[model samples]
Target: MQSFAKPRALEPLRPLAVHLPSMSYVDVKMRWKKDASFDAVPVLSRARDLRPLVSLARLLSPSPTPVSVVSKLRSSLETPDRRVTSFLRRFPAAFVESVGPEHNLPWFRLPDAAVHLLREERDVFAAGRADVTGRLRRLVLMCPRRRLPLRVAQGMLWHLGIPEDYFKDPDHDIAQDGFRILTSGDGVTCQDDDGRELGLIGDGKGKEMPLSVLQLNAMRKFGSVAKVPVPLFQSKGLRLKRKIQDWLEGFQRLPYVSPYEDFSHINPGSDVSDKRAVGVLHELLSLFVTCSAERRRLLCLRKHLGLPQKFHLVFERHPHVFYLLLKEKTCYVVLKEAYMAGGDTAIEEHPMLKVRKKYIELMEQSQEIIRCRRNRKPIELQSMVSCSGDIEDCTEILS
Candidate 1:
């Protein structure tokens, strides 16, 4: 039978004014090194309830003058190390319910057994450490096909005390395989391996970023409310991951904070085609092609700078946010319409936005290109505030 020692001895829970990461919630399972020569040793791991910690601790009780069998037990559990973390590792009820009926080894018994063996002596623990990868690999064979975020898997590793080197190690294929087995697909199309794959996938779009992560846990619905789904390509049943990667191909994302924006850089008093605007235009010119990721970043930057919200639809209903490229200057305003409207004028000749790098270079590099660029912008040549009736109302006096 297994049981946790008197947990009441631990300090009573008090409200901590400070915020702590969720990982800190789990118990710190530490095992003393088997080697007696070492003055003290502490092995930090998250796999707490799963290891043999409780069983071994019980054996190390102050009672020394017991039967020969109890002496053997003490010999097995005694450690040279006095320093230990002060947290009890307990199995979650959910895990307890899941495997209680099927395996006697479930509900952290295996983990406990492993910890007990570790404290038995140095050699035994060393052997188990070497076999850890193969054992984890076998566990992977039974992994669920559902794709989960690395965060959840990492959290599991920490809670389980799998070992820092195991999960941190790129060479440790077990943890990598475990990650793949656990979290393995687009948010939309995945079969949950176990019932525990909750709060893992992103907003059923591309890139498995948990929505809570997106809003920084400030609001529940910010990312979903703002998701502008874009058509990636003509491929069959577009993949969310591929689509997100394709979207990020063009633009870079700025931080979400408002202070990150520098509006002072804009020459507010100058002509529309001032240096700052020109610089923004040049950045637009530098883009090899239109992409959704960059478009999202453009919107985010605008919001960060307290600029107006801009979302452009590339296709029907597939809106992307971007700086309107119609003007030679990069408009602080976002284009809220489709880039290419399928019309006769949207032919191979007259275009809404100039896409040619050579032409933009000509405008930026020489006088001819500058003339072409200036002519292309309607606002540059056309008066935005023209009074139409006043022009026609002129009393005819010229013969």
Candidate 2:
């Protein structure tokens, strides 16, 4: 009979004391260098030292859960020292990347590429890219050599299954409701050749625009990233829009009859029902925000990429139509569904709708897939993660 005993505990987990170097230890080995903006180099350096311990914990300990890491994290936070926090964070990132494929699939591959292209276009216009990159990317880019999250995005794209290069002058404009608008170029908002970013807006029309201007418009932290493509090009018809939307609905298994879209305007003196409708609408907006991205948010961002539970609808421009805008990178999506729900054909009736909330589980848990190769995990096309986030009622590219 084979003996499958505990085997005298292969390796007992050690207190993380030796896991991190003492302050004097670090001081002797390294000095802080002042960078232009952020001073994360030191943190990175510390991560290198602690990494061996973490890897050891993984290999030798009975179990080294994220929870255990979290406990050590709390200890680091409480300690007078701060090196521990950095080690805890970077270690998890490394672990996530290391285990992503072994644990799960990734999105953001080829099949998913079409949606990402569209999203790239949307962010390029509605806001800019780098600004978004700053705020959302932090959480998503956890691992050094990562693949799980991006794989999820790629897989869904394949599963949601759309064509490649769909954003290059898309053949569908049906969603525009019979109108055409286009963006200028990718460089305008960028810091390079053109000037549409960093408050450059445009020279003369686009002047000193860097990457930050979009931050001002998008109202996001990195809104300053100036490079984005916000021009709207007219396509053949609404076929593209219809096809894309239809595909998403089927792919996501969303319900056709939206009860909330209907009752928000009824205002029948019933606060309870109104609130419920509001909640549902809010979910829809989040869905819209993330959905449009396809899998961009999940590909590069995970934590900070969520819809605000609170927002405002301002009738600043188009009369009778209020703008469902976010505080930063303020966005507005089509209010057609809401209008139709309210039994009002007048496009100008309800200009905007606002909502905010807590439970982002649905929007966050959209879909994701991960593919694996030997050393490097290959993110497949069908991988997907929910692209749901805050959505706005954005008009056409040219409105």
Candidate 3:
């Protein structure tokens, strides 16, 4: 038998120190640029305002709810009763006003069309349980310890297309695939089994590592995996200044790093590090069913993802990939691919989107209702209110 030579002592890995020219350290405030096409994207534009309506609809799903009961939800909805009531009245097609049987107070209930649509939404959630869990799993895998706090996951339920009952149901299927929920004195956490090296979109065993939306787009356009994809400006007149454009071009030329890969080797504040940061944001947004998220919501993820203090600036720096929409005094970061060039819609539309479109159709009826009401035509108003299923009661309110 051949004797094996003694192996040399293993050395501890050290962090790499990257050095660059002094100019790279200059601090520049990147001004936010607006894009009309992205602002006009239907889903991103309306989802914020519709969220309150949807939440109230779900609350009233079980039975007609009184204004007093809805008013108590001020803290939950983050808006006062007046605002909530105003919003409810704006959508006559989706919500019907009635008097409570017991208290005779103003009550709200879903219209028949809204009820049927909500039922279909539930069916969609049930059928897509596996997909929702998969998205959650991917999110946890991106964490440093393959663990994610329960509160964070809960916050993401709406964007992930998960039903509100998911966590409350102990028998839910989330515990099926190498995932478990651990409870302790601190709080609840969702963790995956150790030693599993899952990629963003695929397992590492595959020949091709999972590529981000940007990478795939680059490959398609360049016929190879280019480090930087050609940026698509939303507006014809919009243009980047020479200095900023040059800096962006230089930043784009940096080597691309996958979000799922090891990031410890990257140097902080370097161009490579910025690329990794961008990759992380891209992957995180891609996991969402809507491919968009509120900027404030994403701040909760920074510490867990090893992102810089000002990671949000990436959205401003990379307008081609991300779009920042300032609406209702809240900033929403939208992944452009989802709305442009037949991205998410071209591949497969999320079931929630179908429900949303139906809700939009229902909302359109409100315009007609308002038009009829403005004309002070009792005949048309009566006919419309009758169609709402509570003509006798709502007619007085509408008038």
Top candidate (lDDT): 3
Query: Mind giving the per-residue lDDT tens digits that candidate 2 earns over 275-353?
Result: 2323323222222322112112222322122211221211121111212222123232322222222332211121011
State the TM-score for model 2.
Answer: 0.16
TM-score of 3: 0.77
Q: Identify the runs in model 1 with alpha carbons over 4 angstroms from their true place.
A: 1-126, 129-131, 146-148, 158-161, 170-399
In the order shown, what is each candidate's alpha-carbon RMSD?
36.1, 30.3, 9.9
Ranking by TM-score: 3, 2, 1
Pairs in steric clash, model 3: none
Q: What digit string (tens of lDDT, one per residue) describes model 3 on residues 353-373?
A: 666655665666676677767
Write the residue-wise lDDT of candidate 1 on 1-399 in tens digits. Answer: 878776666686767745443212111122211222111111111111222333333333332212223234433333222212111112211011123334442222222222323334233323454333322222222123223334334433322224434545576554333333333343343334343332222212353322211232224323342432211222223333454554334222211221112345433432211222222322221221221112333432332222322212221122122222212222222222123322311112211112121112212222332344457731122111112211122221111
> What stretches of model 3 exceed 4 Å from their correct place?
1-30, 79-83, 101-104, 185-210, 218-234, 343-348, 378-399
TM-score of each: 0.16, 0.16, 0.77
Number of backbone-clashing residue pairs for each candidate, in the order shown: 24, 85, 0
| Candidate 1 vs 3: which has more TM-score | 3
Whole-model lDDT, candidate 1? 0.27
